[model samples]
Target chain A: MSKIIVQGVAQGTVLKTTSPINFLGAVDKKTGVIHDKKYDIFEKSVKDTVLVFPHGIGSSVGAYTIYSLKSNQSAPVAMICQKADLTVASGCALANIPMIVVSNEEFNSIQDGNQITIDTKSEKIFN
Target chain B: MELTSEENAALNGEHGDTLQTAYRILVATGEATNAEKLIPIKWAHLSGVNYNTIGDAGEQFLRELSKDARVKVKATVNPMGIDFDHISEFNHIDDEFIKKQASIRDSYIRMGVEPTFSCTPYDIFDLPEKNTQVSFAESNAAIFANSLGGLKTNKESAFSALASAITGKSPYSDLRKDDITTPMTIRMKMDNPNELDFGMLGFFAGKVGDTSVNISGVSQPNRRSCKALCGGMGTSGTCAKFQFIDSEDEKSEKVDFGKEEMNEVFDELNTAEKGDIITLGSPQLGLEELSDLSKMLKGKSFEKRCLIFCSRAVQEQARTLDYINEIERAGGEILSDCCTCLTPLIDTNETDAVTTNSIKGAYYLNNSTGVNVNLKPLTKIIEDETK
Candidate 1:
């Protein structure tokens, strides 16, 4: 299979999902705690890493979370989105978290454990 | 632009005493967001910032600029006070938090702000009709103004929106509908989830869409539920932030809902199966809600195997009220903003299925974490559990 990658470059700590908590309120910049109390899934701190979500969901403050993460030096190096959003764009621009977007179909080909890379110059993503 | 020379002068800080600070704050905010000129808004809704946050440079700026003007008072709806409840069985009570909202509200009042103290302004506030310029803080409310009532506004911070409200004009940038409403693709089933689920789904969709939406696959919503979806949509995607709902059948009681809100919840209910974990409080919890939860668990203990949810902010507050400790004492875990961004909660070899009321929680867990999700209504869950 031609694993066509949507490559882009970003600076962030590569984070993997271990539990299910909404990404929106998942990470808090002020405290650097990932609050997802109900499920024993995952609750770890994320800072200065590449945080990629197969997709986006959460409060608009999710953008502010990125800003708070960055301003407090608690944010990822960059973010990769299956789709781009107003909050993410504004936050990325405001927080300077380099971002790369890929298509859903393209993302499906990339596995969880696979090491994927993005290059901002060409706005391309690859594994 | 409606400012007379005197109003402009006041905006420029010609006003005396308190009005001076308000004026300068507005000017700086307008510049930051790229407002060409200031316009006088008919109303303003603020988030009633914390006393500590008000001490920042933004606060000083507001004080210096809002001199002589009276601020032409209006109503406001800020976030709930830090601690307003004295007693709750779901958790303990914190008497100390009582003054938190007071301090924040007092400072805003001193600087000329009204504190309606709610997340949903369309519920109570006298919002101007389509194209009527308005200014409001609270992320959820900002999208509500644009997507629900057709009024115009941009997302202003604690101070910026207040400034715009006082000035009666927003930056005039993306607040316009033509600039905000864009189309996007979203694949999610929403069925009769409760109001909380409605809001969560909107958040997830926003995250997935990553901008404002012109989407397919959902339908019909109650007005309030639509606002919840709009609020969530504003979080990740659109400048305006919205979703259109689809419905096959609804009673007269259901007509108030928007197509987007109904479609999502109905889809979830129809599809969700048993044995899923339900989580709540993704955007954080309210002080009053904390009190309610304390009562919910006064005598009963959580089914150790079930899943629950809450925000990091609420966790901190709970600690103060002993709610967190109590929840722990009762048999549940309280975590800070933990998940997706951190180490790995999903990809790890963990549980089988997760259930939640927060639409954002369900969407992210299923999409990002690869977890099976069960979403339900908060009210129904409470009724079932309590009964």
Candidate 2:
């Protein structure tokens, strides 16, 4: 798959969600499972996986939720979004989670449960 | 991003670990936004105070940050999860939740934050001089500082605002200059405009997305009207600052709105039925609003639960002015430093409906709490409650 450099790079199995997540309410802090009822990924565990989504929505406090995930040792190993806003950027920075944005075509090429390595240092994603 | 020698030293860890991390985050954010350099700021207002919203992870992060670093500039904080004085009143909030919330407050206090615990810092704090650069995180407050106060501040994230508070600097970028202030024009034509009309106008504007908008036709809005407008706009859209043109002036494409549009917005936001809880002060009530509410509540009693949330400073003033007595006498509760949307103080399951004067509160409470909310004017809510 074609690679892009948006933030940092890491590799994990993909956990995809179609809806934009508001991390503050969407994810359970202690369990790391998607709890927001609005999304199809409800009850899916994001722990240590490369969480993929379209983008982040809702409160800016979602940034802190991401940090809390790391503090609880329940954070996704990495993140990939179609677009990255301030909330996502701040969360990744604070949590030290590697994240990158990809084009729609590249994002479409990847599926849930796929093994992938996103490398920002080399500016590539290996599928 | 270009950094000065001092900035470089901080980034290089010569200054200290806290400064290094702060500067690094700022630099990264600046680079991401194509900011050429960082500018010094005199003030910073931070959000993300509620323990229910931030949870344990947020508490730990704040504790760690405060251990090594303190804010360099004068800073104020947003609301906590519960009112410290009225803790026993909110039985729905457990002791564990209270303890975690208190820790977050303590960390900010230890960091030398002003502990204002308010979203509407402009009402209590000294208004920044026009063009004064500041870093603010609360969307309503940030937009107010930018649009109404004539101050310059981009809508900051909680993390970025904390970073700016530590270093007293923010990346010099969007909404900081006058040259880039022009936005898509939204012309409002209202007949006999009142407080509710202003609120609906904001609700409509916010739905317009990230497009910078200039609102024309309304002139010289009072503090509460301005608050309602900004709060509604911030809730629905991402526009940070909106220009106000009192008189007709051709600058950009304009969308004219009238009373019909206002009713539509009111209809859309007011989803709950009568006899629901009446909530005020989503952005936290200002002094004038409290005074107005007190006047409306004189010789009147509420049939349903009415909660008025404001800052400690404002509450103190209201108490001194005997407004608190009037509100309490009328069977309304005054909650300070917390509101329904930020905290789990109110049990949503027990609450069948909610009537609020704040569009922001209605929107958030509906989504986060899963309670039916009716957005209405303060006058209407008071009248309904009294009747």
Candidate 3:
């Protein structure tokens, strides 16, 4: 089951990366490019897509990096994580980005390029 | 999460854009953390002041927020990129860096935040009552406030602390809750350990524990060692509070930290055989540390360049006590409102490595500043480096 951590409506194609994201190092704030070659989604753009990752791993400064992305018009439409840590939760709140938490099974089931819709009121994810 | 009528009004945009934004952040954080409601806080110590850390996006955000928002509670900030007073003394800081740094500070000041850029606000500012709730973003200060100051706070992020400052409210969860249970214990097997040893033990405990940990071994540590332990633990992991294991709580799950484990951590952080310069004060030294340093370096001078970081408040007190003259006589340059971690003052072209007692300093200097570290204790540094 996927729970809504931050309530909102977002529908878009998923950009799933199995590796956890550190907003400070893993993504570019200006271009929204996933430049961390260690991850599977290298060279991918997070703009306008539903970004999915395991969780955030980095300094608290990563929260500002997320807000910077939103200000620069390079932010994701929504975020899906297996767990919502303080860093990501605060960043999503600051940027007004919708955040959803899903089970490990559901996270693995959602593949890159998969299309989906999120509605926090009904607490459902439709594919 | 259930919010009070005032909180609801703030979220409903009845208050203003600033409060609406602040409440939105609070409610979202509360919902995420399973907090029941919002609780008022006495203070908020924020981070993200360093331009090198926050970048252009953060600067722009602050500039916009400063226009309409003022802190609802007492607020203080973390260190910026450079010591604004000593800009001409360092080679690494340029005009662009200074301009950006000034803008960040200005934004905070315009929002009614105090320009106390020290990370150790507990040393400089008048602390709130014991058990009173606050929000702190600096990791070391958060650890110290919870463990030593008897205050309640979660390890808040920069944005979360800023939100709390604007709203004077924090989510009632984590360390703020009164129902916190006794945590796992890490027993240190060393007898008569110094500050560096305590630092190693703290780093080990923070790595192993979750939210809180119990440490047993060192008893009645002075202020300097306590600060070192807090700095080391803050650098290692997310562990917030450390407690001494009470004699009645011997049945808890216990881990051991001995010489072997200490050497392992030392080997991990100590990457250099020697340092080009000696640096101190990762958490920024207080009056106590300054007095000790002064006594150690009474007539002797450093053989190489030595940079000491401290807060202007403590530095003034140390000057009144004649500690600053002794330090300066020993060829130590005292920089205020900044510390060794992530400061642009230490240019890689000027020096390759730093020798310090702080585990936090060693970690960041090596990882972020592209330098090596010789992790020696204060006693060892004074013995070998001073003549």
Candidate 4:
């Protein structure tokens, strides 16, 4: 069963990474592109996709960066994580973006470019 | 997470949009962290004040929130782009930067947050009672409060702390919980480590360790050195809440911090053999460091430009103690209400490299500001750069 962190329903292509994100340094706020070369999905745009990652890492400004993405209209339609950290959770809540968490088994089952739907009210994430 | 009737009401938008937003954030954070309920916090020290860090998006966010949100508890802010009192001194800051920075300040003030634009809040402000929960967004302050000041916090983000300030509550999880234990232990193999050495050790520890680190083999470090450790740890990685242990059990996973590890960090940060200018205070120098610097430079003057960053209160207090005068007499510029990290004062085009005693400052200057850093100890900097 998938756990919903933020309440919303959205469908988008999956942009998955095994690496934990630090939104403050990893993502470009204006372009919604992953800038950190260390990550698996480097230089890929996060716009209007399902941002799937392990979790978030980094300092306090990271939350604001996530909000910046939404403000700039470059935000992911929804986010799915194997775990939820404070930075991503707070940002997702503040930005009013849908967020969900899935088990490790389920996380590995999803792949990049897959069309996924996140329905928080129903607590379901399906392709 | 279970919420009280008042919290539920706020979440339901009965208390206005600001409270509704705050409660929603808190509830989400609590649910994610597996916190059973939201606990009231004594204070919140936020860090989104830097215009360079937040840009227009964060400024707009605060501007909108300021219309209705007011801090329920004591809330302190971090440093902005330029020190408003000393605005005319720095040529790098433009009118637009000043205007946006001012807007950010106005928003915080309108929300009833204190204009204490200092990173070392634990140094200047009167601390709350021991074990009291607080929300701190400044990384160094959070680490210092947790490890040394006997206060508890989870090293909150700017948004999380702002939300906590508005609601007077934080999710009781991670470092806030009493049952938390140190997952990694580091044993030092260095002999008589200086402040910079300790900072290197801390930077290494933050990189390798987990949520909490247990460090052994350091005996009673001074205040400035302790601050350096916190600052360096806060700078390099996400590990928080380090404790000094005299001894440890055999079952614990241990890491060693030695000469090789120290050299690796030093080599990584200290890219320049010499620098055009010297900059200090990533955590912002407190009164103790100022006093030490004043004593060190009693009969000497810096051969090159030396910029010292400290809090306004600390700077004023140092002036009263004759420390600021001595530093200024030695050709050091005392920049208050701001530190070296992400400040616009240090222009990379004019100065290709910067010499700094703070490891945290070195990292940010090299990575964010695009300047080569010359990392040195305070004593070495004074010895080599002054005549």
Candidate 5:
């Protein structure tokens, strides 16, 4: 019922990630390795901040990576995108994670490592 | 946002069962792009190899879907793979790729999709005529169809593309190709120029341009660079609809789209720094390409670590020759079937950094693998080996 503050809400279990295709969002659903190799959003770049960005950037194989993490039960609890491309969409669907897409500006408004919450049904984002 | 008559009818059970399945898929894409109505489609290129791999679950699902619905187009070719001992054009392929390749191929065949087995599907068949609406997959091929051939296709999924082809229409929206007027202008440049360096330049150009670029100023480049740029840009900006312009052609239609103008149009979403993993052969390779690499890599050793990958379809041939032996011997591992853009076959933590000559390879590696990738020329890779 509230919007997660860009800098303040960069915490809480990361239910959603908006990382662009370049800066990969990490969700080790298996061992719960929330740290990603793509750019260390949780570990270095944002340091476990609420992660947000555009849709995934790299391979459709991003689908498999998502699957691996999700199957291992280490994936983020939810996800939202400016647009849900195949890689993340497939993974979200397969893993049964809540995913939605909003405007790019709204995506940018989010800061790293902020505690975040999401309303998947309403497509409203909270930080 | 409202559904078109076709989409509305499908949702309301006006269309047949097949149309309904197609409708579900189209509606998902339509909602994403914020399209108002759906239009019928004539052809498509599929994405997603299978609903399930290693088992008949996918085959059964597709077989059931095929029973109720049929594609609308004259021909629909899914992304390519191999079932047997065929061409081996990829690089650094791993073991047991053939089994996975065959599993997916079996699923596609069961779902009634033709196994064209080439990333460049236009080579085998003519694209739907200019402005002929079709569903397509993969960013690079979509760009090639839109800009190079003038055929119209939105970056769609295997399901949506399949739905459009079956229903013979797609949802007409503001995002439709016909809706786009002129391509956006750019002013990007590569720091230095050399042979085989075109790949990296194209990649960066695509990234810089973001969706919908009319770029110029890629001087003295080649065909691979053009494709690489288109492909890489597609990766960076999923909705990128672009045309690499003829920079030197004063009378040409190609416009400028590059790094200089990137700040104007795009919001730098997430950034990467210098030097990372070196990847090759993202979208499956053919046998000849892999064979050539095997020859080039003969007796070569890497001073730095690199990940060499090949598509599973082409890897079959390489495996026959035991190509990985050369890579393992040369201090690198050959990944099969999987491309770096999707996910690292191995974990990213095991490696320090990366570098490569492929723009597509670099973009995926940089973004998906979390490795800062430096795209270099094949010649440079060779030089490093000799050193």
Candidate 6:
């Protein structure tokens, strides 16, 4: 298992999406399902998993969507992105869902359903 | 991130939970962007008000935050989901959606935000000093403040802007740095440029994907044309700012666009065969635009639905000048606060197609609503719809 230091801490099974997620149009706030039909992860629930993606795109309201997910008790346990735009950063912070950015190489090395743990205090991710 | 004593205290929850949360988000954002410190800001403009966009989750967040959080600086809010004054007029919309929209406005007001409810806050508010640091969330307003107003702001998200409003600070990075603000050169030479031509130029620049662009060769542009240009650019791309120069400036690489290129852009953006509904004011119309629109509709009455959206401030001014009455008499409905892009007040299913002069409006309506949008000059929309 490879380990790397990062910004926020969490442990969960990974659910990866190759394409970027736009939470505003791409998410169903009530159910936490990925509603964007264009992506392979469409109809997947983000709840209780390590949601991994390249980054977020589209409306800034995405921050609120993430907050809505958390409020509805349907938020992912953790998130790992190749980069963190303000939308993801702010959203994750507000939702209190741990998030970290990983290098593309490290991100590509992992597969869906792989159990992972992130420790922001220790600044490390253990697989 | 290096934190000042006050910042450290805020992060440590010495100030309050609201400030602590704001500080934590700001610090996290700063870490992501590699910002060294947080800087004080003069103003903060927030977006994410439309219930159709933010939904229930956003409303809960605002409600909770507003209970204990008061803005530290001058802050203005973006448009609500519906026109509050004429709520009864829009009987086509759902009562639940209207209530959500009203709650958004009420929550922001309780948080001490000015009820501007306008995207083009620069139009009504006094201009900030040159190079003044501010925080603005709306893409078009942020671009305009940076490019035209000569103020400094990054394209902020709703949460980040609200954080800045509460804390009176923002992560110092990107547009705040003077060295990175220098733009690359993209020269444009157009013959007899109009508002539509300017919008096309902005669309082309957005397609280029350059953050900072210095454009030359455009003749003196009026405020409305400039607004259209910046609005289109911000909508289509992530450009922070653009500078316009005279035709004689010979120091940079230039791209020249003519009538052919303009027509190509129009073809790409126009998806409607004929417009069933005509909508305007994506960034919310300025007083000048309303005046011109009123004049254009003087002798015309449309059988199809026509909606003109503006801010409460501008709407009041238009009323004082009798422009609202003339537009209404000509069979046009004037809506305030929200526009076609942000709200579902205008049902795409009810109308076969939509038309607008606003490039931003056309793009968002087409993408978000799955509606066919027709891109035309305002004159053409008026002429075709009236006939």
Give me the candidate number with maximum TM-score. 4
Candidates 1 onward: DockQ, in order? 0.08, 0.35, 0.44, 0.62, 0.14, 0.41
Q: Per-residue alpha-carbon lDDT of model 5 for A45-108, expressed as tens digits? A: 2222233456666433344445455455445566556665655554444434555665667666
lDDT of 5: 0.52
Interface RMSD of each: 9.6, 2.7, 2.4, 1.7, 6.8, 2.9
lDDT of 6 by residue, B115-170 (tens): 99888898888887899999888777888999889899877777888899999999
Candidate 2 residue lDDT tens string, A1-127:
3233235767799999877777765787777888756579888889989998976654567778787888888999888887655566667777788877778987888899999887788877888
Candidates 1 and 5 compared: the better one by lDDT is 5
Name the TM-score of candidate 1.
0.51
Clashing residue pairs found in predicted model 6: A5-A123, A5-A124, A6-A123
Task: List where candidate 5 sits over 4 angstroms from the true fold.
Answer: A1-18, A21-35, A43-52, A60-78, A82-99, A102-127, B1-6, B12-21, B50-70, B74-101, B181-184, B191-196, B246-356, B363-375, B379-387
Candidate 3 chain B — worst ten consecutive residues by lDDT sum?
A: B244-253
Please provide, for model 3 over B6-86, each residue's C-alpha lDDT reduced to its tens digit, 9 standing for 90 to 100. Answer: 889999999998899888888777876678989999999998888877878888889988999999999998878788888
Q: How many backbone clashes does candidate 6 have?
A: 3
> Weakest 10 consecutive residues, lDDT, candidate 4 chain A?
A19-28
lDDT tens digits by residue: candidate 1, B260-346: 755654464333564334444443344445555666666656553332334344455567987666555545444332222111323
Clashes of each: 126, 0, 0, 0, 74, 3
User: After best superposition, candidate 3 residue B288: deviation in angstroms?
Assistant: 0.2
Winner of 4 and 6 under lDDT: 4
Best by lDDT: 4
Name the regions of candidate 3 deviating beyond 4 angstroms: A8-58, A72-83, A103-122, A125-127, B248-251
Ranking by TM-score: 4, 3, 2, 6, 5, 1
lDDT of each: 0.49, 0.79, 0.85, 0.87, 0.52, 0.80
Name model 2 segments beyond 4 Å from true: A1-7, A12-22, A25-58, A73-76, A80-84, A101-116, B189-197, B246-271
Ten contiguous residues minimizing lDDT sum, candidate 2 chain B: B25-34
Model 1's CAPRI class is incorrect
The clash number for model 4 is 0
